[model samples]
Target: MGNKLNQGWLYTDRINAKVVGQTVLDFYSQRYGHSDRQVWQERIELGQIAVDGKTVNPSYPLQAGQTLTYWRSPWAEPDVPLTLPVLYQDEDLWAIDKPVGLPVLPGGDFVYHTVLEQLKIQFPQESLFPLHRLGTGTSGLLLLGRSALGRRELSRQFRENLCRKIYRTLIGPCSLSEQFDCHQAIGKIPYPQLGYIYAATADGKSAHSYGRILARSPEKPGWK
Candidate 1:
């Protein structure tokens, strides 16, 4: 596949009772809301579906709670601009304002059109290392280490929680207090089209976010 962006076993889940006793083809046809059995059968013949990590025949009997995995074919991604504005730069570190919709690293149909790849072309002499990453849909400032020693120092700060970053976001009306702190555990879970999903989970690392209501909608009219 040409750049194979956002493609993988992006879709995976455990089969439940409703699908038990049915053929894999039948289960998928119902599970995906597609009634065409022939279409699913073709995918099965290609070994696109796996049960308990093993490829099986299309007519393989479904089992309750068996893990099902599917590798999605490559799909097109938006042609977002690769270069971003340089907010700050020095011999050791570079802070760049990354645009929304641009991926930080290569994934899902995006290889050469990523921030990492673009930076390499922008600064051919010094080795560039990413200190952190932002979601493809997010727009914000990103920090990068320009050299090996710079990379290590910045990486240690993040790993040890010594570095703090503040993000600005706009949301709907809320009745929340002016200031608040949320200490919730967050982690990544497999999702369908987006690769991995990040959210609060019981079995996750500790995460903290501080929210301060800047202004209400009408109160802060004309706000970007």
Candidate 2:
């Protein structure tokens, strides 16, 4: 699809005690590094940011329980496939074959070019929300919930480990092993570009994955 001009966006957040004394500029620049300090200052000066329903200077000190709102001007978003193939559908659930490169949610430089936005456009009358997420580069079946009761129950199942999720990936060739398991703890580490990102670490939360060899490619020297 061609690049689309979004109808702007209104983002709001509540100031918490952790950042109660931070300046408006510092809060945004430190927490959200999408824009630089100069860009944030420009937006604040243009009345794009407000606290408690009133525009404030960049140096304005934030207080706990205050509402901060930002009006992001409409801009052209990156082009992406806007098609979603329905694999299964029911009264309370839907399973879609999500295409690769389509973001499951809005983040980074994507806003209107996400699966959630396409869902809104295709099913305007229905209130469906994604129950799980797939990476932008992964193609897989995405499950969505159409009712609050269904969503709550499925969320509970996921939290309690009642659901089994299996993923297939291509990796460099290694010694043959019938089956393998990984117990690497994953946690966020500081990243200069995007604040923090998940990686395996000793003090991170427990994570496990099971892999079974499906096939091997002689030409590519990889296992799937």
Model 2 clash count equals 0
Best by TM-score: 2
Candidate 1 regions off by >4 Å? 1-75, 218-224
lDDT of 2 by residue, 75-117 (tens): 8877777899989888888889988878888765676788998
Tell how far residue 93 is off in model 1, in angstroms. Answer: 1.0
Which candidate has the highest lDDT of all?
Answer: 2
TM-score, candidate 1, is 0.62
Off by over 4 Å in 2: 188-204, 221-224
**Using Cα atoms with residue i matched to residue i, what is each candidate's TM-score against the true structure?**
0.62, 0.88
lDDT of 1: 0.78
TM-score attained by model 2: 0.88
**C-alpha lDDT of residue 108 in model 1:** 46
Tens-digit per-residue lDDT, 132-224, candidate 1: 988777898899998787899999999998998887777766788999999989897655444455778888899889989877774545465
Reference-based lDDT, residue 25, model 2: 96
